[model samples]
Every structure is written in C-alpha cells, then in structure tokens.
Target: MTATVTEQVFRLPDLGEGLTEAEILQWRVNVGDFVTVDQVVVEVETAKAAVDVPIPMAGKVVRLYGEPGTSVAVGAPLIAVAVPDERYREEERAGSGNVLVGYGTGGGGGRSRRRARVRQRQDEQPAASGPGKAASSSKSDPLLGPVSALEGGVSGAVVPSVSTSRLAGTPQAGEAAKPAETAGGKASGPGRKTAAKRMGEVPRVISPLVRRLAEEHGVDLTLVTPTGPRGVVLRRDVEAAIAASRNAETAQPEVAPAAAAPSHESAEAERVPLVGVRRAIAEKLSRSRREIPDATTWVDVDATALVELKESINRACPDARIGMLALLARICVVGLRRFPELNAYVDVERQEIVRLPHINLGFAAQTDRGLVVPVVHDAHRLTLAELAARLRELTADARDGKLTPQQLTGGTFTLNNYGVFGVDGSTPIINHPEAAMLGVGRIADRPWGYEGEVRLRKVTQLSFTFDHRVCDGGVAGGFLRFVADCVERPEVLITHL
Candidate 1:
C-alpha cells in the first residue's frame, strides 16, 4: 500500500544531560538522500561527548537545517524529511527511541522546543557624519546590533564618536552625562534612550547562553560591536571584544602592538571559535585553576613486583587479562578505603567537606576528539577482576568517543596514567571539585638498592595532586606513600583484602 507523502521538519533533539547545545560535526544523510527509521542522520559534538543522532521516520531528507560546524541549540530546526507515511509524528517533539547517551528522542525533543523569534529591527539607518563617507550612529543600539566605524580613522565601538558627540550631546571627560530635555520637558534624546536601554527594554537576545556568557566575563554588551546581520551581536563579537580588552590591558607602554603602527595590513586574523569539547576543557581547567588551591607531591617507586604480579596473573589466566592502569586503579580504590578524605569534594557555599559514600574513579583517556575522563561509577563495590573488565570497557569507549555524560561525570577521584606517553612524571591539575588525582609515570628498569646492593629494577614515579583545603600534607603524603609501597610490594595489598 502506497502511503501519502508529507514534509516533516525535525529539530535537534535533547543532546544529553548537562549539555544544552552541540556543534554539528557532520551530516550523515545529505539533502535529497533517503533515510530509514532509526537511521543516523547527523553527528554532533557536545562538551562531554560526541554521539550520532538518528531520525525517527524513514524518508528522503529534503533539507538539512544546519551546516557542519554550526552550533544548533536544542529544539532548533535540524532537518526537513519528506516521508511516505502519514502516521509519522513530528520528529521535533518525539524522535526515534534512544539515540545517544544521556538523552534521546522524546516529547519536546529539544530543551527549548519553542523556536526563538527572529526579530529584525529596521535595517539600521545610521546617521551620516562626513562628506562622501558612510557613517553609523553610535547610540542607535537597535536590537543590540553592530555599528561599523565612520570615516576619518575610527576603530571598534569607541565612546564619543562623531555621531554620538553631535546628536547625543556627549559629556566632557569624567562628567556624568545627564539626559537631555526636549520641548515637552521630558527626558528625551539619544542620551535618555541609552540610559533607558540599560535599565530595561527586553533585550532581543535569542539565546540565554549568550547573556550568561557576557555576565560571567563581565563584558558590556553595549560596548561590543555587533557583527551579525542587521546589527545583531553574535558570540564571536563578544569574544573579540574580550580579547581586545585583554590585549589592551596587558599591552606594554612605549611599545605598541602592530595594530598601533598605522599600516596597510588589515587587522584581521584567522580565529577558531572554542566550541564543543574544547570549550568545555577551557572552562573546566580555568575553574580548577581559579577555585582550587592544589599542591602536588611525587615519589619514585619500585614497580618490579607489580609488573611481575601482573605478568603472572595474565599468564595464569589469559582469558582474564589485566592492565597496569587497572592495577593502579585497584590500588587507588584500596588507598581511598584506608584514607577516605581524598575521596570527597568541598562544598563551597556550605563551607563543608562533604565525603562521598562511593568512589567513582575517573581515568584520563586521550582521543581524536580530545582528552576525556571516563568515570567508572561505584569503583569501591567492584572486585579486582570486575574493575579490570570495567576499566577496559571504559578505555575502549572513551577512545571510540562513545561515552555518555553519565559515564563522563560524577567522578570523586581521578587516576591519570601519563606514562603511556613515555613521560616520567607530571604535576597534573586536580580534576575540579574532586579532592585529588594520582598520576603514574613510565615504568622503566632503573638502578635501585636491592638487599644493600645497586640493581636494575622496574621503577616508576607517582605524582599526587590534592586540594589544599582538604586534608593537609600529612594525609596527602600518607596516601602517596601507601600507593608507592603497594606498587613496590604487591603482596602488601593482600592485607587489605
């Protein structure tokens, strides 16, 4: 039976937990290409992980809403599918069943399914300034849009421009500009409008994320030049303003930057927007540096025993293969049990050191996407064999970029094995909120005192970085020493068993 055809528009469904937006990585199905139910139509990268999204209905893709690298907000139009089935529901509200980790197709596919109203304030009619030159009104902040510079050597949105000084009644330096009075004796003119704009006027911002970003960085939206069409300010505009301000502040006196040298070279450079995983890494690492006062301590350890033990175990049962990282993870679990202070995070608001009931161990894994730390929840509950299997599965998933938000978050402690890169040791930043992290260096045969004689033995360095607000040097040193001791003599772990 031939069913009737219908054009259906599908919005990007909810990406997953804690992720509000995703950058379109690639479109699996192109326009005019037929797709099937539960078929992957696009791949998107969020801050946490990358996952493929599937369409709910079988149809020919009539239109793909966003292009690759476009940051599509949830509930925004993603694609228009022309399907033969009249019974198919709108893919925006209800997509095919589970498509990715943490989130999937369902009612209200996107968080904000209500499309943002695209408003266009009259195609900016800026007042002219000089002869034979296009000029822009500095005070005409229509929809918080951008205004290009006027003639006679002007740059970015600067205060007291020709238009603003002429029509806006520009005040003198250090003088508070009072609102100009009109014929009716009411506070009128560009000055009053600018003041009122700051007070309130329902800013025509389409995304709340933009507003939040500005607030976080203490950026004044008015001062930033809007580069989007029709004077609309985009995120890139704000970011550029931020970079300019930073450079101005850091610039040295008596030595101006190249831009100051009035050259014919345009003051533009290629810039890649920090979006998706890269953005997440920047924010998180910056937070860790800003908030956590961490200290690192490292020690050389003899790993000959641990190495031999792993080889013995693997040889005894090849089917139950174990890895050195899993072994280190086991040691961490045991150490946390002995000293539970390291297995918790600080609550800043309550001024409390909240200890967690379970240990969710996060291990660092580098992938083509980026460095992701996939967590193994409830590590304390898993047996050594189970732990090994779980770690193997997680490492594979992380390398594959298939980890979900649930698997990437909720980590109480972190194990960073930097040795895979053949490095000796590193003072890695403690993953934020988590109290401490243990880093393992490369294990190599080194000369060590064995029975009062120098002998070449397997050795490695263990570095531990912990939040200073947590337990002091005593507890941190004790934890590191214990791990080193266990690594040197694997039999000592039997005591805890």
Candidate 2:
C-alpha cells in the first residue's frame, strides 16, 4: 500500500516592535529532518535584535524557503514540512494545540500532495539525494511532495513557482539515452548540462523573489541551465552560479587594493547596508529631530562627593563595585519625582501632556551592534544598590545583544552616559515621545573653590535636553539644579525617598 503524505507551509511571523521583515541568520533544520513543535528552526535578525523562530508543528521538513543572509518578509512562506497521512491523522485526533504570537494552531488538516511525473524512455532512475529522498519516496514517485518541484532538488533555495510538469524532457524509458556532447567530447547527462545553462535564464524563473535575487546578484538567468520543470531556472541555480563566480574570483591571485596608499582616487570607501536595527535607529532619530521642539540646559557639577561616596561604598562592599552612572541614574529618578513633566510624552494628536505615574528609566549603552537604550522598569521603586545591580546587568545584556523588546522600550525618561566615550558634554536630542534626556560627561579633576581655598575636584558636565512645550526654562532649570545638587551633596537624594 502506498502511504499517504501531507505538507504544511510555515510563514515567517512578525517579530515584535512592528518589524516588517527579518534576515535569516541561520537555519537549524534541513530537508528530510524531523522537527517537533516549538523547536527553534531559524535564527533571524530583525530591525531590533537577533531572535530565534520556532516551528509550530511536528513534521519532516520537505523544503527550506530562504538562504542565510536573505531577507524574508513577515507572513511570507518560510518552510514546507511533510508527514505521513497516519501521523497527520493522529495529530488531528490528539490535537497538539500549540500556538505562537500572531499565529495559532487550529484543527490540523492536510493539503493536497503533488503528483509524480515520470520521464519518458529513461534508461535508469536518477540517484535519490537531498530533497528527493523522503520516507514515502519511491522510484515511481521519486518526487515525494511539492518541494522537489519548488527547490529543484537543491538545498536551501526556493523555486516554488516552477511546475513539476515543465522540467526539460526526462530520458525515455527503455531507450538508450544520449549524453550531450561537450567541447572535450566527454559525455554529460542532459540534466547536468541543463543545469549549467539554467543559471543565466531570467525569464525562465517564474518566482518574483527568484527574479529579484538574480537581479541583485547580477546573475544572467538566461545563461542558467534550468533543472526545474519546463526548463525553469530554480533559485538554487542562481545562487549556485553566484557561488561559482565567487569561487573563481578567490581562486585567482589577489591584487593589492590601491586604497592602502590613501591616494585621493583610491581612498577606501565601504558601504554598509542600512537595514535592520541600524535603519530603525536612523529613522527613529530622524523622527525625533523632526517632531520634537527640543531645548538644552547644562551645568558643570562638582562630582567629588559622589565619587567619594562610590569609593566608600566599594571599600565597604568590595564585592559590589558600584558604578558612578548607577548613582547618577538614581539621582535622575529623584529629579524626575521633583519635576514629573520631564518624565512624560507630549500627545500631539490628543493635545495633552501625558505624565506617567511610574518611571521606566532608560540608560544609553553602546554595543558592537550599535547604540541601544535598555530600560529598567519601576526604577523609582528600587533602592540605589538594586538600581546599580540591575543597570549593570542590563548594560551587559545590551552590549551582548541579548536584550528583549520589552527591556529596550517603554521608557519614561532617558539617562545618557556619554562620559564613557571620554567626551566633556553634548546637547543630545531627546529620546522621542519622552520629554527629556540627561547626558553625563566625563569626570575629571578641575580647579574648584573648596572652603574658600583653591583645590582640585572631580567635576563633570551634565547636559539636559527637554521638550520646550512640556515646561519653560524655570522647570527645566529646576530639574537640572536638583540633579546637580544631588551629585554634589549625595545626601539630598535621601529626602526624595
């Protein structure tokens, strides 16, 4: 008895933060591999961060839709999985009700299985390999499901637009097949020769995605030898061509780039793709500048006391090395309490200033990926030490690219520690929607008047940018003054608690 087979198509879902697309960083499974529900199948880098996507069902994967480094839009088909009819029936009866965000598992049902197409007058069957081999794969129906037609037996490439009926004429059965003649008089099978020419044929590719990829890579599809039905060039064929072209380039000896000499003509220019998180940042910053009528107020603070307090605490608890930024952040929370207008967003549509009850303090952290602000929720409620520990952990996580969407947003106010970059001060733009941002400059020994005597003190510049519409100079100055006083005195912060 021929066992029945069923296939399911899994589409990429929206990764949070209103992301429209994500680039496939890596795939965890390949064709013919069995996968369980909720198993992480692919790692994708979105506009915010890298995240893993889980498969929603248990089945044997028949085809993977995208290659690594390729961008796939949300709701686009990602992979196709096939399973036996009985297994599918069992899944339906038992109903493994697993669900994912934006996608849900309802009643399980099977889709129509693609039929087999036999080549006429073929002398022998092509060896089963890669995508062609399946649990129910057979000589008569060597093509197990839609994947063989879609991927054209190539791994990691999508070629779903091609129909199985259209692949170039397969060898007739019981008739001696003639191998295509090469320039060297060596005989090659029609399939292999067909693939060689399929890489250059653009019109033969029916998938819009495949065409776009061909255009991007500058692959002449007309020269591509089609391996799919009706002489259609598969996506894999285009990628293979690209890979071969790259290999040929690497095989040749490299010529030194003239950029090394730093000549005006040869000055090295590199173009980085402004996509994903970087693009999102650019758009957000641009929007902030475009929308917010922001103003700046700064003060040079005597941080000597704050520094000494941190040193004393560290000496007392050597295991917990308290960071200066943590102390400064605690002061910011206190300052926000005194001036709540700074911890709010202006609602232009509603014509209102929405003041938040709780403070979700965001701190600027620079990472290899880029600059990101990780938020500490309910920061106002935490003790100074607790705030310090959480800030340290969150900063480390941000630098390591492990922060989640929740940890990166919902901030009521921002504290920027530009001091780490060895800068003295900067009038930074406010983080959008939020009314203000506090920028801390580098701490350094500067001449100061201590007890009417000339002395050197640890001093730093504190730059504060606030939305002018939120409050006038008086409120902004008062907020900055309160923060500077806390930094200088350290004891004044106790009153806020």
Candidate 3:
C-alpha cells in the first residue's frame, strides 16, 4: 500500500523566560531516523539552562537546519519530519497542546518552507531522507552537517581574549559560515549568488550588526549579495563589500582619510565570537548597567559575634554546619523583612515598585562555567539549618552544571559573597530586575574599638547596591544598618527569627 506522504517542520521553541534563542548542543536523531511522539531529538543550551527538546509527533527526520553549536532563533525551522499523510493531516486538525511561549498551536506552518540542499563534492554520499542514506555529500560528516569555515583555520584575528570576534567582517569563533564549493572543490567565492537566486526571493537575512555595517559602509545588502551558509549575510560578507568599495575609491582618491583610521585599528585586534554562556552573561550584565540606576553603600562591621555564633552552631550540630554565607543569607532575609522595599523590583513599564511577597534568595557562586547565581526559593520559610543545607546543595549543583532554569531564576534578592575571593569590597552592580544585592567582603582580623579599648576583632566590609528607583538612600541605609546589627550582635537575628 502506498502511504500518504506529508512534511512537518519543527521549529525551535522558547526554552526559558526571556530567551530569544538556544545553542544546539547535540542532536540525538539523524536525518532518515524514525522518531516517535515525545522522543527527545535535540539538546539545546539556553541562556540560563540546558534543555532537551522532544519531537511532538511521530515522523521520519528529513532534514536538519543549521549545525551543532549554531544558535537558532525561537521560531526558526529546526528539523523537518515526514509522516504518513493521514497522520500529519490529523495532527494539523488536532494540534498538540505542547506549545511554547511566543509560539502558537500551528507552529507557524504557514512559514514552513525548505531550501534546496547544498550540492556536495566528490567522495561525499548523495543526499537521502530516510535511514540508509546520508544527509549531505560534503566533506563534513553528514549528520553533523558542514563545519563552519571559521573552524578550519580562522583564528579570529579580530578578538583575542574570547574565541570569537564581534568586529564587522570577522567570523565568530566556531560559527563562521560554511562556504559552498564549486565542481572542482573550490569555494564558489563572494560573487556567486546561486543560493540566493535559487530561492527565487531575497533570503531571510538576520543579524542587526550586518545591516548596521552595510549602512555605515554605504553598501546595499541586495547589491552585495550573500555567500554565507544558507545565503545569510555575515559580517565578513559586509566587510568584503566595504573593502571592494575602498579599492574602487582608490581610483577617485577623493574620500576622507578619517574613514581609513578604523581599518588600521581593526587590523591590530583579535576577534572572538561571544557565544554560549559568555554571550548571555555579557548581554544580561550590559542590560543591567543600562537600565538599573544603582547606588552602593558600604560599611565595616565587627563580624566577631557572627563568626562565634557560626562556630558554636557548628560545634553543637556538626552534621549541619552553617557557613558564613548561610549566616549572612539568614541575616539578609531578616533585613529584607524590616526593609521590604529593598527586596522589591522597579516596574518601569508600569511605573511602579513591585513588593514581592516571597524571597527567593540568589547567592553568587563562582563555578568553572563562569559566574552563576543559584537561588534558594522561599528562603524566608526555610530554617537557618535548612538554608545552609540548600545553599551548599545549590552551590555544588552550579559547579557541576546541573542547575535547572528554575534554580537560577525568580530571585527577589541576591547575596554576593565575594569574601571567599579574599577581596575587601566591591561596588556591586545590581542584578537587573532585582532591586538590591548585598556584597560580603573577606573577614580579617583588624584592630577595632571595643569596650572603650582597641582590640583585635574579626571585621568585614559589606557593600549593598540598591536600585535607586525602588527607594531613597534612607531605606538603603536602614537595610544595611540592620544587616550590620545582625553581624555585630547575632542575638538580634534570634529575636527576629
């Protein structure tokens, strides 16, 4: 019996709050592989979490868009699945309810379109859709797709510190476009516009920076054309256009010398692609600096009492030893109760300060995978002992890269214990969307005035950064003072708890 044939395009879905796209970490299924409903097809890394995506229906994988390590937008086509015609039609009628935020039930089937597979070179297998056939005939592994040219020998002379450069016309580390090859196994070169012309339309070009570069260089994108993977215009493509223009300008010799200054500087720099977690952190931290009007206030506190309290607790209950961070976090929860405004967020869109009822406290933890803040939810409800246990657990999880999206977000307040790093003080930038962050510096023995005499006491510097829009300095001072009081006299926290 001839089965009815239908194509289903699966697009990348929103993996977490505020996530625009995700890096394709790995693909569990290959083209021509038969996958059943709810079978995990790919694992993606979002900004705050790593998520596994499962296909919503049964089908045979036909094509995979983009390669592993490439970032795919939320609504971009991920994979195409071919199913029995009757099943696909039924699925269209009775669409699955497993929809993602910012996406609809139909999954944008109206935009479901596919491009012709790139022609491969000799020694590569022919493209086939089902099991027994290869996905591409390129030198690259058919399943992994073609490796970006940037990975071959491009060192990103544009950015040195990180792997990828963000400069115009430079390939991001590991994510440069895979150039199409000619019949003789040579790059088709920039002038070739076969991929764009074959689509019978202007290719859907993304990348705001590419457009901006084109504008700055006075080059029309359509006129320049595309040679990047899937006919997308890349930074290098725009740069090439500008270079071509400059070569043309030599004949005229009338252009300003100022235009050449930037090129000289660019030649000296190394470029790296801001990808993966590094890219996310850069974007979030930049947003925090731009949006949050923050103010920092610091004080030196005698942490002798707090330190003694911790020792006593650890001695009495060795099983659940409370660390300094746990104690400070406990003190922070108490301080927030007295200064609730500091625990709130500014809703600029609504022009209001939101007072959160629960305190999901996030503590800064430095891990191998950059800096992360693993949160303890409903921290106000947890006992001091429970708080210590959960803090340790989350800290370990963060280091192990096992934290979930929920564990990393929804924090009403943050505790940054840079003290572990042996630093004295830091003017903390407020974690955006949250009103305040408490920074704890290293505890050291310093001469202090105690009982009308100078004596050696354990002292630490505490810096508190608050969103100025949430409250004035008066509230900020009050919160910091309350926390200092708890550190000076651990007995005070006992009364509040």
Q: Report, for every candidate in turn, its global Cα lDDT versus the true structure.
A: 0.69, 0.72, 0.71
As for lDDT, the candidate ahead, 1 or 3, is 3
Better of 1 and 2 by lDDT: 2
The local distance difference test score of model 3 is 0.71
TM-scores of the models, in the given order?
Answer: 0.62, 0.72, 0.66
Candidate 3 is scored at a TM of 0.66
For candidate 1, lDDT tens digit of each residue in 374-402?
99999989988899999999888988888
Which stretches in model 2 have alpha-carbon errors above 4 Å? 1-8, 81-103, 106-199, 203-265
lDDT of 2 at 433: 76
lDDT of 2 by residue, 247-301 (tens): 6655644458963554343233333445557888898899999999999989999
Total clashing residue pairs per candidate? 3, 28, 16
Q: Estimate the TM-score for candidate 2.
A: 0.72
